[model samples]
Target chain A: MLKNYFKLAIKVLGRRKFFTFVSLFGISFTLMILMLITAFLQTELGSDAPMTEKDNLVYLPAISIKRAVKDTVVERDTSYQEGIMIVDSTVTYPERINSHSRSNPSYYFVNKYGRDVVPAKNYSIYNNSSYDFFLNSKKLTFRALLTDERFWEIYDFSFVEGQAYRKTQVDNGEAIVVLTQKACRQYFGQESGVIGKEVVFEGQTYTVSGVIKDPKSFHVYVNAEAYIPYTNLPPAVLGGTGLMDGFEVVYQAHTPADIPKIKKELEHRANLFEEFRDDYATYNRLEMMSYTFRERYADNLYDEDDDPAQNLKTVQWLLIFLLSLFVILPVLNLVNLNISRIMERSSEIGVRKAFGAHSSNILFQFVFENVILTFIGGLIGFILAIGMIKLINESHVLYETTLGFNFKIFFYSFLICLFFGVLSGLLPAYKMSKVHIVNALKQNQR
Target chain B: MISLQNINKVYRTKTIETLALNEINLEVSEGEFLSIMGPSGCGKSTLLNIIGLIDEPSSGNITIANQTVNGYNSKDMAHFRNEKLGFIFQSFHLINDLSVIDNVELPLLYRKSVSASERRRLAEEALLKVGLKNRMSHFPAQLSGGQKQRVAIARAIVGKPNIILADEPTGNLDSAMGNEIMNILLQLNQEEKTTIVMVTHDESMARKTNRLVRLFDGAQVS
Candidate 1:
């Protein structure tokens, strides 16, 4: 019975060339867009590579301090009528500074403090510009992170050779550096085991201590060209070491199940620290490293309760709602086309009814037929989606972020096609099923 | 094989009520071949639909094969139609996508007692009986009008229904093709004793049946 229905459905769909083409075009295009976005999402947010232990790591990417309001007058040089003049402006703002703190501070690893370790992003400045050095006569300049041995406890870095700067080296302010695989090649004539080799930076020489694979561009939050101890960077260049801006504390939980307890403990630490701090300092935060990508990239500008985790959930639901809207429009188009199709098949349907096809049978047959159509369309969409993903990747829109097809995508596309098929076929099939058989047959005679 | 008492079919709208089949009381004995003749809009087809259980009579009591079908639900009626009755139409009503054998196999699909193999075997037998066994693989579009009607007839009897309801089975065919269809119908009635209720406008064809019921303006004339 189902075989006959399929035979008839395929024939009928082929007979109406324009209708079939229009329906397929709509369905395939909609699915293709959805697949492309899904692939990109999987690549961006999927827990892969360096983010593998994302579940067990909590990151304090930013700290907001609600300090006493301070009014300060700052002089700015402004040009008026082709002449430079000094102007004084009064600025009132909270001392909620992360990258810069007025009070003295110390590194978490050095102080043996804060219940966790921290890796600080350090930008070497020379004459108001990022510092660079000549290596093999080519200028090499890359962002760097300054940290101690405990930094390795919270991170999972795969080293090709040597190791991170040791605690002794960090404390001794030794001139040692860890370079990424790409950096090692750049500074050491493409050599892999160039550990202990010296690289020049800003007229100063630092020995390479380790080499690791360069993180992909998507791992921008923690990615850097080199790593060194904060103590190596003269104190003034670090914008005041420890508990300062550009430094985010990463708490390595024993297991993901202990995260809630860790968060509570973090809050307790913040409160305890606040008791001894200048009457204005305030603090609260511990976001999962995986969920904090957006906030981290945005320089952790999110306010309390606007944590990236909550923001991510809202964004996910919004994307789903938007994608569903895309699905609904094409569904309505297919339904309208199916309804029009009924005009030609009414007699066949009426005959089937007269021969004992119940309304339910009619409904099921129609929906099944439509599902077959959508399934075919989905295949086309899968191909088109691959093409689109390749195009986006080549365009470098997301910096070599790939959107390749995989088993999960295949499953998703299948369901999307089936959903569109049934959603579109329901109303039209129901309407035709309810038509009086006599009337339907009567129309067929005409 | 079939009994319809006080059958009435009416079409109602906001402004008008049209009688399609009124006080239609008839009985078709087992193995009987009966034809109902009428002019256009005489409600012969409507009465056929009501008897076939495709349309509900406004008021009527129907019994077929000793089963009280007056209050049968839509599901039951559909099952009854599939098991106990078959239908043929003026346009032949062949599903154009399918081959002749597949068209014949339609009724057997609803019968749980028949396996797929049995359905195929029975469909082949019906096609052979209709003298179109060689054309079993040909779609309806490739067949002649006469061949299409033969396929329809094969479909009607493939389920081995005791009663068959046909409406202008050869109406679209020429006189020669029409004669061919009549001969096949006559052969079924004679050899299998299959009861038949047919609606037509041709008096000559009506005379050939065991009995004729004539209708005018939704009412029986004789």
Candidate 2:
């Protein structure tokens, strides 16, 4: 029975080539956009290689400090009734409330609280900066990630030549750096045998200790061309008094189950800063927050006062709303088109009804036909999305990010096709199914 | 066997009410080939629709094959119709997208018990019976008027239902093709003893049937 429906659906779609094209165009275009977004999100948010242990990792990107300051207001009233100074008064009110500052945590703070107080299997502090240099008489810019030796343990970067710098090299403040494949190609115009070559940046020359694959844009923390030890930075900048700026911290838990314990301990360590500092009397409260990659992404949209976990829900709802809006507009158009298209089949419906088809039978047949149409459109969209992804990658629009399809993306796209198919097809199928047999036959007569 | 008591079908609008089938009382015996003749808009098709269970009368009790179908829900009525009744229409009503064999297989598609091979076999058998076995792969659009009607007849009988209700089955064909279709119906009635009720306008066709019913202006005249 289903085979029969499938065969008929193909023939019917071919009957009106223009209508089929319009419907397919609508369906395929909508699906392509959805697929591209899904691929992007999967790349950015899914636990792919180099960050495979992302579930057990937490980021301490910023430190927020709140202090209350006194604000004085003076008011003078000189309102008189009948030329009399009946209401002449001066008053001053002093209020202390609401002042906050936020920035990346300092290395000093991480050494005091992060390494000793925080509970974690491993911790790494890193800072990102960019430098420009004249290479081959042309100016070029390269982003640098300065970190301790433990940063390598926290992030598993794929090395193409040589190996990461050791703790001894970092501790001795050796002028050594690792370059990404892209940086190596740009500087040496080659991929290998340049590990010991010296590259000059900002009047300082450093020996290349290693070379690695270029990180994609989705690798937020690791997305840089050059990597150097944090000791290379000035001591004054690393030992800032206010613990309110300079470095970002990442902790690796022993297991995913230990994430909550590590977060609790980090929170406890942050709370201790108030008691440990002599300037405790200057602030009303002291608090610090840490988040996983997703929460940190969500936190980017919120202020220091907003809880990222709570805001995550809001962000999710917003995304869902936008996606639904994107999908529903096309669906409404498809529904209208399907109604007109199916109207031409009223005689077939009448004949089916007369031949023992229940309303449900008719409904399934039409919906099935529509699903077949959608699947065909979806297949086209899949091919289009792949082409678009390839084009985007080749165009260098996202820089190093190379978007590609995976099994998960394919599965999600399949689901999207089904969702698009059923949602657009149900109402029209139901409407046509409920059409009275006599009325449908009348439609045939006309 | 089919019975109808006090069957009434009214078409109502904002200010007018038209009676399509008024106080229709009918009974069709098993294996009896009955013909209903009437002028245009005189309720022949309406009565046929009601008898086929495709349209519900405003008020009526219908019993077919010892089962009262008056209170049957849509699903139950559909099942009853599938099991006991077949329909043939004036326009052939063959799905244009489907081949003649597929069209003949339409009624059996709803029968879950009929497997795919069985459906194909039965459809082939029905086409052979209609002398269109050679045109099994031809679609409705490729066939002549006579061939289309034969395909429609093959479809009507493929399920082997006890009662066949045809609405102007030969109205669109010429005298030769119409006589050819009438002969098929006569053969089915005599050989298989399958009860048949057909709506027609030809006096010769009506005379060929075992019984005749005449209606005028939504009422039985004879």
- Name the top lDDT candidate: 2
lDDT of each: 0.75, 0.85
- Chain A TM-scores, all candidates? 0.73, 0.89
Candidate 1 residue lDDT tens string, A268-357: 555444333543335332222222344343333342344566665566666789888888888888889999887678887788888888
**Quick one: best TM-score, which candidate?**
2
CA error at residue B191 for candidate 1, angstroms: 1.5
Q: Write the per-residue lDDT of candidate 1 for residues B20-76, one digit (tens) a residue.
A: 888989998999989998899999988888888888889989998999898888899
Candidate 2 chain A: 10-residue stretch with minimal lDDT: A275-284
Query: At residue A444, what lDDT does model 2 achieve?
Result: 56
TM-score between candidate 2 and the true structure? 0.89
Q: What is the lDDT of residue A117 in candidate 1?
A: 27
Query: Candidate 2: misplaced stretches above 4 Å?
Result: A69-97, A218-220, A239-245, A256-286, A301-305, B13-15
What lDDT would candidate 1 get against the real structure? 0.75
The candidate that achieves the highest DockQ relative to the unseen native structure: 2
Per-residue alpha-carbon lDDT of model 2 for A1-446, expressed as tens digits? 99999999999899979878988887788777877777777667766656776788888888766776667666667777888886565666676658766678777787677774345788888887888999989999999999889888877889998899889988898999999998999999998789889999999999999999877655768788899998898878776665766688888988878888887887777666664357545566555678887787776666443587787777777778987776788788888888887888898898898888999999999889888988898888888888898998899887787776775666676677678777677888899899988889878552
